[model samples]
Target: MVFLVCLIFCFLAPALEAQVAVRDTVLTVRPGDSLLAIAHRLLRYSTEYTAGELVDRIKRENGLQGDAIQMGQLLDVSLSYAELLDQPVIRGTNFAARGIYITAALAGSRRMLTLADALVAAGGNTVVFDVKDRYGNLGYASSVPLALEIGAGQRAPIAQPAKMLDALHRRNIHVVARLTCFYDARLARQRPDFVPFSREGPGLWSERGKSNWVDPSLPQVQEYLLAIVREVAELGVDEIQLDYVRFPTEGNLADAVFAFDPAVVPKDRIITDFVTEVERVLEPMGVLLSADIFGVAAWGREADRRTIGQHLPDLLPHLDAVSPMLYPSHFEDGFERIDRPVDYPYYFLLQGCQRLQKLATEHDVLVRPWIQSFDYRVTDFDSLYVTEQLHGAEDGGARGWLLWNPASLYEIGFAAIKGFTDSTAATVPVKLRFPKSLGMDLTRPTSVAD
Candidate 1:
């Protein structure tokens, strides 16, 4: 199939290439400059090019053989300043995305229809649902060969993915397939050679004692992930957002062992190479790719990033956007010297956004944080509480924000964004209906009154 596309692209290549203006701006390399550093320094949030993309252009133009750049060396950048800030819309939405997270369970349920209506009515244009969840389960039936080989699709939660896509796509929602790449219990159990290990045993690397990760260092694991990505892209989803794309974050990290390529490739490189390959393969499919990273990752913490194998700069070259899980409740008490980070969502989130934007924007990548929507730190989380975090994200210059509600509950969330409704007068539909054409079980208790 890809071969056919390549053949067509080759024939139309000249005409397609003609559409690009191919602008250039020159810069002299400074003392501390490398190709990557230059890319980060000059690249901006623009549809014209990603930082790595422009850097690639610079290399091609300058006829460079390696990453080596000396001080006073002249380089030509293919993007102008104006082009750097221009945000071209994808599926009719800007990089400044406003959306929410829906779990695999709720995605397959009837509630999503009403929730979809509520989201659309609330002026949100984007929605992200699960395709593959953290538990190593395929949320929907996958055309990927490996998924079927391993029985990952057995008793799938989302039986009618095409139908669900139709329902959501009809509402003009930008659907992103959320796939957990490395944190897969199913994949680990089925392919023990693909999982992390230690002297302790199979479950040596885990979060909270649940070590079910498919090691990123394994080439076999990457192949499986690529297959899943290709299948998801074919599902007509707008974007692919990888969750848990990092290494195991919990339990006996010091003793954990990788079955392949250990002590050779750096953790960050492993993650970057994996994501880079996924992006390379899927870009032709017209699906945008993004990865969820730890909130501290945006700050470029060496230890933090190395631990998770997700360095913001390394990932920037390969993704459409990077979403940091900035749930304030997840932070520690001594975070940034704030004794109680939970009590100060605004402080931590705002700070996180500031640093994150600095790191992400330089690479021509955008930051869309997963802000706290569910009650965790605030026992009395109200509209104002949620509002503060939302505003903080905006104030810190986040391109967009996505609200995370684990149980699919969003009462305070809705109340907080009441003004988003187009009509001032209160009105609600008596019953919400899913598209019967999708062949879903229509019998569902309604909570989201349209």
Candidate 2:
């Protein structure tokens, strides 16, 4: 009988490996434990379901709402990987997502349609629109309770995000919802406890002499952020792009007091944990989760990673892709031996590509970089400059890239697109940056009105 049972199990193993993320264990929720945190501890080795999805499974199995869990509640979870082997990949064009960032205002207005048509003509396949921007405002009406509590819907700039997403979907465009994770001035002002303490006092902290950051460690903060993410995921976005996921370094550094684990843990670890939590929840939903980091990350700065709370190697395990904002202009002069890094666009991103190659291989995460679209600190910048950035990224082995124009004007970028691709019929227009969160639109145009 034993021999027969062993033979049967051996035969079933291969089949099981390809078709199941099965229930392999049961866990009891503990006091103060968020469902995602518990899943993170339990599924450290899981490849099939992210900790967030595991949390979802737990909630479904236990009939819980939101992230709430009673202490000692028994939860059943999956552990099989073979089942996920047949799971469908991200829902979009299988090709690399060559794309651009569309402001909420543009997307919410009539110009969004024009922009979408233009992008399609430019040989672009993806449109990553801002659902929740840097100011902590929602572009769409969010269903999360905390979102409602904080008047996120009231502050929404995009009148109808769902319809807008549907319109893009018809174009077969992969819609990646961008959420400015922590650099939310609105959320900070509303929940002062969430932001780090300013140097001047034991109170709220802000970056750039403004803009408060969300504390990554707080349970409420994590749940609040993830709730919005979940709502957006349900809206059928192909991916959830998380921006500003790091600890601040731009302003008042010495006096900034992190509310959660300020002295107990490293900043990079905190950022990693927060993203890991998001990955855990989003993975089960089968939605792609990406985090945007400072371009300096790819340049290989361990110190910078630690200070900013975005360590590439550490974050790889929990992310589908890591977008290092590799804009050459953001780098200092003499960066990578170039007198002005911005002028030598090809080499600036080339080094980043070569550097990220090893990390991407080691971690198996996609490296989709963000390129410069606006004229920032450059003299006589033109379409050629934009093409250099594109060629640099492609040659450097970046999977894809997104163009960023704070003012929503991509005339220079359009010119580059025209020169690089065979597509000639394109119109370069001046699009005003839309109204946004964080009090004002920092990138709004001086000549145009919203």
C-alpha lDDT of residue 442 in model 2: 26
User: Model 1, range 1-450, lDDT digits (tens) per residue?
Assistant: 432343334333332311333334456777888887676555431122234555676789899987788998877655432211111125622456778888877877668878888877676767888888877788877767778877888857665565567667667677888988888888877777786767666445555566587778888899999888888887778899988888877777876778555467778888888898989878888788888888877556678876888777668878878888888788887664555667766655667777777656667777788878888867667766666677667767778788888887877676655543333323222132111222433223211111
Model 1 misses residue 243 by how many Å? Answer: 0.8
Per-model RMSD to reference: 20.9, 16.3
Runs with alpha carbons beyond 4 Å of true place in candidate 2 = 1-94, 198-200, 261-263, 423-450
Lowest-scoring 10 consecutive residues by lDDT in candidate 1?
80-89
Candidate 1 Cα RMSD after full superposition onto the native fold (Å): 20.9
lDDT of 1 at 345: 63
lDDT of all predictions, in order shown? 0.70, 0.70
Cα lDDT tens digits, model 2, 390-427, are 77677667787888888778777766776677734222
Instruction: Find the 10 residues in a row with the least total lDDT in model 2.
Output: 427-436
